[model samples]
Target: MSRLPTRTDTPPAKPDPADKRAAWADAAKGVCIILVVLWHVVVKDYLQIDWHIGVPVPGLWGALGEQFLPLRMPLFFTISGVFAANAVLRPWRVVARSRVAGFLYLYALWLLIHTAILALAPDLPTDRATSLLGLLEQLTITPSNLWYLYALALYFTIAKTVRRVPRALVLVPAAALSAVAAAGLLDTPGNRAGLYQNLVFFLAGLHLRPQIERWAATANRRRLVLTAGAYVLALAAMAVAGAQRWFGVWPLVSVVAVAFGVTAAARLGRWPALGDRLATLGRITLPIYVIHMPVLALLHRLLHAPVSGLDGVGQGLIVLGYPILLTGLVIGVSLALHRGLLAVHARWLFALPTSRRPAPRHVAAAR
Candidate 1:
């Protein structure tokens, strides 16, 4: 799979211990993007089903799966932060007209596209006056997963300040806040939301990347321990969530678990057959993530068998398993699409400009 974006690859090279961190970070991206695919594919479809499996997802099966949901996006940002931490230290001119401004440009373009689509959707909010002013106001704020981009721009802008401060010190407070969020003590504005929540995941992922890499490469003991412990804690929490929302916290814990969990899974790559499959799946995560939804939706419509309407044990499998099967189709198609023809413009989808754009000649300044 292609490696992620990093500042070190640009102009003056900085030493990136790119060996293990990059590999595992790539692995982490694969894992998170699968979780991203699953978020839409599994949960979205599963919720539509009135039925459960034999027992329920509530026990071991459901508990195991729930861990990745909350922590995935933040992990992506954390990985981004590890990269972003280096960028802002460049000259101020580079920081202003370059990094943050360029991201804002992309944000505006995408935000307009995203909101415009929703506005154009069927039977729009009639009483809710859909004014251009409101749309513009909403763009200034944030939209759906669009906040990730905005938050990332901010992280890149202020990364130097974060890098200067003790990473351990910054992470400690964030971890504490995560703990609070986990404990339901500070469950304000939703645990998955706002500036504060993302900071916790971003810092944790950045600070913990080195440690995660070391654990991945080393004696199997630590990784195994982290995985088993995370599962036990996660399942137990999910069991608790049967009554309350505390089980929601295990999803975050599971993210931590998977960082370790995949280490054991990575060993599978040593075997020629399994290894090749994993590496290939990991490689196509970017394109698959971008377009997985339309594929799943299409599959759901096409496979409108009576099984789709099943409730409980029968229902969950059909509803959930169908997407997983289709996801394989999406991945295969995305891979084939890249190889067959679309490789020419593949860069456009994973697009982010490299060099900073020149500031528009300010006529006022010229005056």
Candidate 2:
């Protein structure tokens, strides 16, 4: 004991607020991506079939997806805004090349990929550009289900352009646009409705970055529970009053849901294992989001016979388990495809090719 040198253990370092905020955003993104894939699985795969089961699979799952309408895309756009908060401040050309160009390149590339794959699975029940004009329409005037890419390209441009404008001037009109779109006063065909309704959220995330970061940094179990309760009560009130579609109602509901989402995600980040998994998914959401629909479409066609044969067997379990299993499968297959593509040096499918070869994971994943 006397001969042995005394040693002292160092105390563990406290988690940094910045790291916490990043993890919180990643976890929130993870939740959003899963919901996106699940929505597609339900609508495009589950509801597309004639299960012929006694259970009201379509109605029940449809209603569930509808309830999540306020949360999914709004939180997604908001988180995107938060990530691009600094990018907008960079030189215009840089933002153009990195954000605008990157998004548009992916949009055009995937538009073709989706069109080609979806053409073969025409009976799988998804919207796609059928002709050259339809492709042009999707490219210019209207966007397809892959509109998120188009929206991001446009949003980044708008955000960077208006970064010098008064926040109220920019946000008020964006909010009005959302209200009108939500109220069905605007004609937002295809996924244009999402493109229109979510700009306010993205702008809010960009404009209110400090507040959002502060909220995430200070989020706790108590605050999360309280915020979630308020969100539920608000939803209940809206439902009771039949104002879910009122001009301002949807945006308000979406805001509350975003609050709850952020708080819940922040709290989730405090946990080590699960948070890490979610954060990892969050970082790679672009591949899952872009590729899931096509994967699901293909799977639906390939598995049609098998899935249909299960119609009468364990109807109850199939009702709930089918969508969940399909969602997991779509996500898994898409991720595997992404890795496989990278393994073959086909990274350009996900990112813009540069003169100097880009990194294997060069895709802009902020969205």
lDDT (0 to 1) per candidate: 0.51, 0.83
- After superposing candidate 1, which stretches have Cα over 4 Å from the reference? 1-18, 49-64, 82-138, 176-195, 219-222, 241-262, 265-272, 275-284, 294-320, 332-349, 353-367
- Could you tell me the lDDT of residue 330 within candidate 2? 92
The list of candidate 2 runs beyond 4 A from truth reads 1-18, 357-367
Residue-wise lDDT of candidate 1 within 72-117, one digit each (tens)?
Answer: 6655665555545445557777665555665555455555544544
Error of 1 at 341 (Å): 8.9
In candidate 2, residue 24 scores what lDDT? 88
Best by lDDT: 2
- Please give, for residues 1-367, the per-residue lDDT of candidate 2 as tens digits: 0000010011113335459887888888888999999998888878877677776867898888877888998998999999888889899988888788888888898999899999878887677998899999999879988888899889999999899999999999999999999899988778888899999999999999999999998998899999899888888898899997788999999999999999999999988788877876777788887788889888989977677677576555577778888899999999888878877877777776667765455474532
Each model's backbone clash number? 5, 0
Clashing pairs in 2: none
